[model samples]
Target: MVSLEVVHASNARLKELGPGLVALFVGATSGIGEYTAKAFVHNAISPRVYIVGRNQDAANRIIKECETANKDGKVEFIKADVSELSEVDRVCKEIAKKEKHLNLIFQTQGNLNLRGRDESSEGLDRKMALNYYSRMRFISNLLPLLRTATTTPPHFSRSVSVLGSGGGTALDTADLDLKNTFTGSRCAGHTITMNDLMTTEFAQRESGITFSHCAPGAVKTNLARELPFWARTATKVLYQLITPLTVGQDETGARQLFMATSGIYPPSKPVEGAASASGVSPDKTIEVTKGASGSVGDGGYNLTWKGGVTNGKMLPEYRQNGVSKTVWEHTMNVFARVEKINQERGNVK
Candidate 1:
């Protein structure tokens, strides 16, 4: 397990990486995304970071704080309810129009609702949409820009999904959408496994970009806001009892920022000495960790909260069955259907 001090050391040296780095923080209005966005602003030199979420009030507050913290850095808020794929497309188009390349895509949008399978107007589970589909859509829409970033030396483009990595269960390919077996737990499992497969699939296909799916352990956040008052109260009580063990929000943010900027997790064929590019000396440099494919530095990683490598129980079986391809195909079909509907309604020009 990587210590918080090492995480801080790596983040402290982000300035050596480069200036004017571009990052997009989905669901940054609150929780882990909010904290990490601020960390980026604090560390990066003249970074142009985009904050995407549904809360305008929170966005305004965060923008003010970030701008005040770093006069050289730019933080813009693009408000949208990302649970819908249409909005995701619009947001991505806006960013694509404004920027030539994106250095990082940090996604931490999710919900913890015990209620089962609340379908969006676009015909997918809302929780799953937030946790999985929208994040993948953002990556897909912006991959061209990411590839553009990689054409240069010291090439750096990464997509980090803050989700249940290494916690996936068996996947039921016949019902990837879980329309018939839609329990809260089952939906969670399906999304978790799908994310694992999605990262591996993207890694294999896109060799230049890095993909990571990480579980941020247990950090106190408003993720459970949708739960009933009683449940929320009970959750608060439980967390209070385990406060000593839970990771703090600021530490979580710092750790995630380290993962985002550190070269310890490089692509399949990284530039020489990429692992030491974080400006850390040889003694402090972290060796490249194995990716989800069990290959060292293979462009895709499944990370625990401490930024260590981990593998899900069902990954081997699902990989043998070539389920990652099915997940990718299913995701594309969903996006195509949604875009067609969006065009029909004049949601896209």
Candidate 2:
């Protein structure tokens, strides 16, 4: 594994890959998503970026900043609440109508925590709908566009979900939807697990589209506001204490961009040096890297602020339960139901 150094936002390395890329950022009105979008715009020479958010005014402000930062890049704002399926469908439809393909989709729209259970008008839990299901809805709706984008030379398209990928514990497959059982932590854990299961399923099915679920260690963003008063205060205290150790927003954005553009994590490439840009010889350990304490590896790429891929052992329980396939089928069923209902209402025509 290679150690990636953290750098300032104005570094020239970021600009090297941003030009000509078409990216859609959901939940970018604030927090890490906004910072990531700004980083891309700053580095891009002539990129077309779509900013999706609930607040039109805020979204416009972000786009203006992006334009000011990179005069050559084109920025457009799509105002919508991504938690709503109808809104997600409409936003994606507009994109399809305006652009031929999408090079990258960064799904960062999610509520950190709800003080109490809340449901959207669509009759779904607000957090679950926004954090997990809505993202999958957007991806399923836009899969064709993503595939079309990669048809040409140097085919590259990626879907990146910003969430926890390394820790899969406390994931209750029985409560995937959170209809009967729901708590702040349980909902959060389920969201991460569902994203992992769905992403891996999509990777296996859609060979051309690269999928990644990044667990951003920590970044100071407005997302902490979603927590209750006590929780928010506790989080603020911890954040202030840990900000020095956390990855900066720009570095987080660059790592995400690397995941999208870098030819790492390929399905067919011999899993040696698969993540290295230098094309060095592969490592022999079952794990990607061996630490002084022990070998550190996750079956998939578990990246740090610097873009290194490592492997780790899967829990025997999770491996034995075969949750991936179950989640896959369950998610598809939900999508099918939503599609059918939308069709009946003439929303999917």
Superposed by TM-score, candidate 2 places the C-alpha of residue 103 at a distance from the truth, in angstroms, of 0.6
Please list the C-alpha lDDT of all candidates, in the order they appear: 0.85, 0.67
Off by over 4 Å in 1: 271-285
Model 1 clash pairs are none
lDDT of 2: 0.67
For candidate 2, the TM-score is 0.81
165-232 in candidate 2: lDDT tens per residue? 65544556676777788887777877776676665567666666666677766778778776789999
Give the clashing pairs for model 2. 297-311, 297-312, 298-311, 298-312
Rate residue 288 of model 1 by lDDT.
71
- Candidate 2 Cα errors over 4 Å, as ranges: 5-19, 228-231, 267-305, 309-321, 340-349
lDDT of 1 by residue, 246-312 (tens): 8887898998887787777776764455543222221245687788888887889889989898888
